[model samples]
Target: MIYLQLFIVFFQIGLFSIGGGLAAIPLIQEQIVDTHAWLSISEFTDLITIAQMTPGPIAINSATFIGIRLAGFAGAVVATLAFITPSVILVMTLAYIYNRHKQLDAVQALLNSLKPAIVAFIASAGISILQTALVDTSQLPGAPFDYVALVLFILAFICLRKTKFDPILIMLSTGLVGGMIYLIL
Candidate 1:
């Protein structure tokens, strides 16, 4: 039953996520945190930090991490397979069709519709991350509310608005600040 659930849950993510692994974060959170109750919100935040530190796709790292935490080695294997299989199939099929019908109206329409869905998926992912990262200003946790986090978020936003700095650098700096805030105090 657990294996089946893992497959179906990740299969849904694969089917819907248009952009890629980062865009799959909301679905991962929905399954691992909200639906399965497999990890605490804090743990999920930590797992995301760990995932970013690693060298692969964030979604794959998350599936493996969360699955192992939930049900050990076998769970990681099942979850990893579930996360990739549908996506592989869909991408292969789409590539074949796109090669054959590069000028078709339906293909063009599909690509057009895909743009907004991908944006929506990424937006959903951002919202899920925000839910874990932000604390209610009313309820302080030990080290006062993270004004530093808010400032970093604003700085990242401004940098994105004006400059063309690499996004990975922004994330790394924020992660560093977050780690310092969580650990130092």
Candidate 2:
């Protein structure tokens, strides 16, 4: 029953998660954390971090990790397949429609509308993650936030916006700096 439920939940996530994996974060959080209680908020946040750091799509990585934690290897397979199936079908359908009506004004208008929705989804996900990362609610009433993390976040933002440095290099440098800070503190 749990296996079936996992598949159905992930299938729905895949089917309606327009604009790709990042867009699916809110849905995933809703189902896995709020609805089913499969993972706590902090665990979900950690999952997102690990998913981003690892290879492949964030959705697939999350599905695999949660599935394996819940059941086993077979569960991982089921969740992954369920998460990807809708995307595969939709891509094929959209490809055909787009090829046939590539020049239609309505199709172009619809595509244009989707851009803002995609941006909204991405922004929501970013804010969610940022809140979790910068706020340490477990601390005392007066010390509920991680100032160092906020500083690092601002520095990273500035580096990415102001410098033409490679993103990978920035991430690596930040990781090193964060590790050193951890050691010092």
Candidate 3:
């Protein structure tokens, strides 16, 4: 039953999350955090962080992590497979269509039209994560903001935009600094 549920959830995520992993974050959060209550917002935030840091795509990584948390290795396999199945089918079909009609103006227009929606999805995901990272939403009425996180976020953004530094370096440096700050306070 749990395995079935896992498969259904992740399969839906794969089917509808059209703009790739970053854009899938909100859907993932909705299913895992809101619908299932399998993970809290903080846990979802951690999951996203771990998913980003890991090798694979975020959606697949999230499925594996949530599956293991819920029902162990077999669950992980089921969730991972379910999450990828739609993408595999869709890509193959789309690839064939695209190759056949590569020069069609309508096809190009359709593709171009999807770009804005994808950007919106990514931005929504980023805002959600940023809220979780910077503000204590659990403390609602007068939640204290994490200044350290804001500083790190700004610095990371600046580094990526202006310095051409590897993202991993920024992440590691901020992570280390955040850890030290937390330890001291």
Q: Write the per-residue lDDT of candidate 3 for residues 1-185, one digit (tens) a residue.
A: 99999999999999999888988889999999999998999988997899889998888898899899889999999999999999899899989999999799999999899999999999999999999999999999899999999998998999999997899999999999999999999
Best by lDDT: 3
Q: How many clashes in each candidate? A: 0, 0, 0
- Whole-model alpha-carbon lDDT for candidate 2: 0.90
Q: Which ten residues in a row have the lowest lDDT in candidate 3?
A: 16-25
The sequence of per-residue lDDT tens digits that candidate 2 reaches over residues 1-185 is 87998899999999888887899999999999999999999999999999989999998899888888777998888889999999899789989999999899999999999999999999999999998888876675765677778888899999999999999998899889988997999
Clashing pairs in 2: none
Provide TM-scores for the models. Answer: 0.51, 0.54, 0.56
lDDT of 1 by residue, 72-185 (tens): 898888888888888789789989989999899998998998999999999999987765556564565653555666777888889888888889987888788778886976
Cα RMSDs, all models? 9.8, 8.4, 8.9
lDDT of 3: 0.93
> Which candidate model has the greater TM-score, 1 or 2?
2
Q: Between candidates 2 and 3, which one is better according to lDDT?
A: 3
Candidate lDDT (C-alpha), each: 0.82, 0.90, 0.93
